[model samples]
Target chain A: MTKYVIRRLLQMIPVLIGATFLIFAMVFALPGDPTANKCGERPCPAEYVKKFEEEHNLNDPLPIQYAKYMGKLAKGDFGTSFREIPVKDELSERYVVTAKLATIAILFETVLGIFAGVLAGIRKGKFIDNLVLLSTLFVISIPIFVIGYVAQFLLGVKWRIFPVTVNANATGLDSWWQLLLPGLVLGSVSVAYVARLTRTNLVENLRADYVRTAKAKGLTTSRTIGLHALRNSLIPVVTFIGADFGALLGGAIVTEQIFNIQGVGGYIFSGIHNRDGVVVVGAVTVLILVYLLVNLLVDILYGVLDPRISHD
Target chain B: MSTISTRRGNRAEAAAAPSKYQPQDGLLLEVDDLFVEFHTDDGVAKAINGVSFDLRQGETLAILGESGSGKSVTAQAIMGILDMPPAKIPAGQVRYCGHDLLTMPEDERRKTRGPEISMIFQDALSSLNPVFPVGWQIAEMFRKHRGLNKSESLDRAVRLMERVQIPAAKERVKAYPHQFSGGMRQRIMIAMAIALDPAVLIADEPTTALDVTVQAQIMSLLEELQQEREMGLILITHDLGVVADVADKIAVMYAGRIVERADVYDIYARPGHPYTRGLLDSIPRLDQKGQTLSAIGGLPPNLTKIPAGCAFNPRCRMADHVCRTDLPPLREVEPGRESACHFAEEVLRG
Candidate 1:
């Protein structure tokens, strides 16, 4: 088992490299120039542009600049944020807010999604199956931005729950409560997609011949499902859940915009708008890393689910 | 949803169905005019129409029939494993020791199915679960029926594996069904069927899917087990050659009814029913050298649109005007040998 895990973990390097390279190329290959964005709307003075250009290594060729960026990324240097002022408390505090919500939302989504899916799949023709079918459809059909706005209207503005938008001036615990509404609105949507994927996977698992044999053994239907069916079904669900979770972690740009949460998603969105070159590329790079890591974790979970699964 | 709910319901019923067949104080199983039908889109496909039989201690009754002969249906009906909707028991009484199996409570039926009267399915590989170790699968019988603890259940599994003659029973008990060959798997199925020492065993086509060599081995194993356990064995099959040496009595099923029933020797030597006679003649026997082997002409009649006179009238060469216009009652062709044919007397006297 240990050898299997080690092999899986090591196998992630190529996947990460491939993902990082793709994201790097996409950002660079886009129409707008990163250096032009760095100069701002009014355009900098000749000397000021030159100084800024040299400071950011714009004088280097495109290939050299890309290599240096990847090199610094390797050394854990995310680079200076594109802002008029220096590193400050406001930005750091906002980053923590988004991270906390993302972590909590992930935990809630995975647990609830997998639970409902497996439960419904095993019971198959029961009420739980119908509930899962309806719930996933309901969640998947709505847009994430619409989900945020609707949640704000119903739970925030009308019901007087959490604040509709994060109070821009809030700090620490106050920020969490202010941002909690957006998290829930967004999390529910992910749950729908994940649950549906899980249900389909689990249903297939229960249909396996082994499952029928388990039932024949006169094992209670529940034990047959729990011990024999659940684990196998969870293997496929892991793939979808991992991929979806990584996408969620990549940040919902519309969700951030509507909620007034200045987290990674908003940071990236604002970076593109304000031509903050460093933040845009840096945010995307973080997402790639997260995506790669999540996939690797899923592969390990697959092995846990089915012992036959191995990297080597 | 409906299909699944019904299957779940049937599974529950099948598990419970056998408990109703359990021996109360003396008798283990009883069936009287049991009628099972298939509810198709067109109409009810009467699979087993008015079939009745008794199973006693240490006796093997080989219900012989070709495909669609209702031998398997009778066994399924007795076991209460018949899937409903597509299949239904319209009217009939299946009583196990006076506990009406058809009308028994669900939980009691579940208890009877495996504990009191278990079944060995036709396709051993398909019937046994592929994921679980064959031993655990066998042990499941002990756990469910006998209420053995986990360790005890697992241990019983190993013992059953050993008893079934699986190689390295201790270790093989941990291997999955796919690891074993066809014959070995059928033995595993046998081990499971006899797990709780059920009062009655319904081995439906147990050796049908096996090779000729494996077929004899399974038949002998069943005979040995039947002798040792003294449980009533109902061997449902089309192979007369295999059952000739094993069966105590032979019940010949044709077109959803028993056309003839007799002692194995009587059925083999002086076959009573036309269908039984045809079946006997078809076997390439060493005793009948240099004789043209007789083959039964025409296909068996479909149960849905049976002939008005005798179900077998269209296929039988002896059918006359009387045979084509009137139904033949099951009557004694000779002592203890009954044949359901209009010309059974003339055929017997010949």
Candidate 2:
């Protein structure tokens, strides 16, 4: 198992290198002068342009530039944003906000989705099953932004239950309350997706022969469904949850924009608008790392859930 | 929810049931007029119709039939393990001792499943949960139903494994279903079934998936255990050759009904039903090595559209106008022998 984990960790090196290189190339290969774009609407002086090019290694070839960036990254230097703010410091400040939002949303999504899904799947074709299926379908059909706005209007404007926009200065419980609204908005789509996934997975497992054996063993129907069937069903759900959680952690862009929350998503937007290669590339690299780590965690969880799956 | 609720309601009635009808002396289980149907998009398929049988302790009753003859369905009906929606038992009486299992409350029925009655399914690999260790799965019967604590149940699981003659059972307790061979897995299944020394043990095609040598071993083990516990064994199978030596009585099913039933030796010596005769003749005999084997004409009828009157009328050579118009009920041909055929006497004269 240790060897397997170590091997997987080694394999990530090439993936990380490729992801960083691709993001770098995408930023540099854009039309028009990126250096001028970085300087904003006003044209920069000849000396300022030269200074920027030299400092950022724009004067070097792509390979040398990549090597230089990798060297800097290895030494834990993420460079500065176009606004001259240290990327690392900026990321540290906003990371907590995004983490809190994603965590809350994912927690709600997982608990509600799995619970409803298991019910619908086990009782397939029954009234409660049909109701859950239809509700999930309705949730899935609507766009995220529209859902976000409707939530904001109903929960924030009319009901006055939550603030429409997040309070940046808030801390602890106040901060949690502020995060809840946008989190729900951000997490709603995932809940529907996961519900559908869990329903399909669990329905298949319920029909499996082992489930019949469990019932024949004199287990209560609930216990048979929960302990025997549900564990097997959760194998595929783990994959879905891991990938979705990683994506949420990457940041809910429209959700962040709608809530006016300052997070990594907003950082990426500003980075793209200002043609800040360092910030965009840096944000994407971190997201890729998270995605890989989540997948690895999911694989490990598979070993726990299924005895047939050996780590080696 | 509706399914479970209705089952629970039935369970309540089972608990309230007046202790009026006692089982015939020495009989452990009595299944009377059992009817099972499956409702599908196509139509309702009558799987088992009016199937009745009696099982006595320390005896093995082999239910012989081809595929789709309702042998397995009867077993499932008796065990109360058939899935609903697809399956529905309109009318049946599965009485264990004096208790009606069909009307018995869910909790009461559950109590009966592993202790009063237990079942061993055909395919062991598919039947055993893939994720749990074999011992854990076996111990689960004791844990949930018997109210044994974890370690105690686990110890019992190990003992059961040893009793079933699983090699290195102490070490193999942690092994999963996929790790064991087909026979070993079936042995594990048998161990679990007999764990509580159930009064009636139904093994639905237990040796169907095993090799010939392993089949004999499994049967011998089952016989040994049945004698030890004085357990009534209901062996459901398609193979007549396997049951001849082991079964005390044989019930031959055709379509959804029992066409013939007799003592093992008598049934072989003289089958009163044409369908039973056909089944016996079809077996490849050593003396007729070069002769082409006899096969029953046509397939079993489509369950949704079983032919009118006798289900075997289409296949029986002696099927007549009387056979075409009226279903032959199972009638006594001799003491301890019954056959469902209009011309049972003519067939018996052979």
Candidate achieving the largest TM-score: 2
Q: Write the residue-wise lDDT of candidate 2 on A1-312 in tens digits.
A: 889899999999999999899889889767767567555688888898889889889888897898898899788898998788988888877888999999999898999999889889977889988998899999999999999999999999999999989878899899888899999888888888788888898999898888888888899988999989998888888778877888888887899898888888898888888888889987888888888998898888778888898887
Q: Please provide, for model 2 over B1-350, each residue's C-alpha lDDT reduced to its tens digit, 9 standing for 90 to 100.
A: 12211111322112222323233555779899999999999999999999999897677999999999999999988899998868999998988876789998989887778766889999999999999999999999888866789998888889899999999999999999999999999999999888766768899999999999999999999988887666789999999998888899999998889999999999999999999999999999999999999999999999999988899999888999888889999999889889999999999998
What docking tier does model 1 reach?
A: incorrect
lDDT of 1 by residue, B1-350 (tens): 12211111322112323332334433556788888889887776778878877776667999999988898888877776555656888888987767787898755676676666778877787676644567777877777667677788788778777777888888888777777889999999988877876667888899988999999998999998777766778999998998989999998888888889899998777888878888877889788999999899999877777778888888888888887889887788788989898878777765
The lDDT of model 2 is: 0.87
The first chain of model 2 has a TM-score of 0.95
- On DockQ, the leading prediction is 2
Measured against the true two-chain complex, the DockQ scores of the candidates, in the order shown, are 0.17, 0.71
Q: Model 2 misses residue B4 by how many Å?
A: 37
State model 1's lDDT: 0.74
TM-score against native, each model: 0.80, 0.94
Each candidate's clash count:
9, 2
Q: What is candidate 1's lDDT per residue for A224-245, written digit by digit as tens?
A: 6787777666666667666766
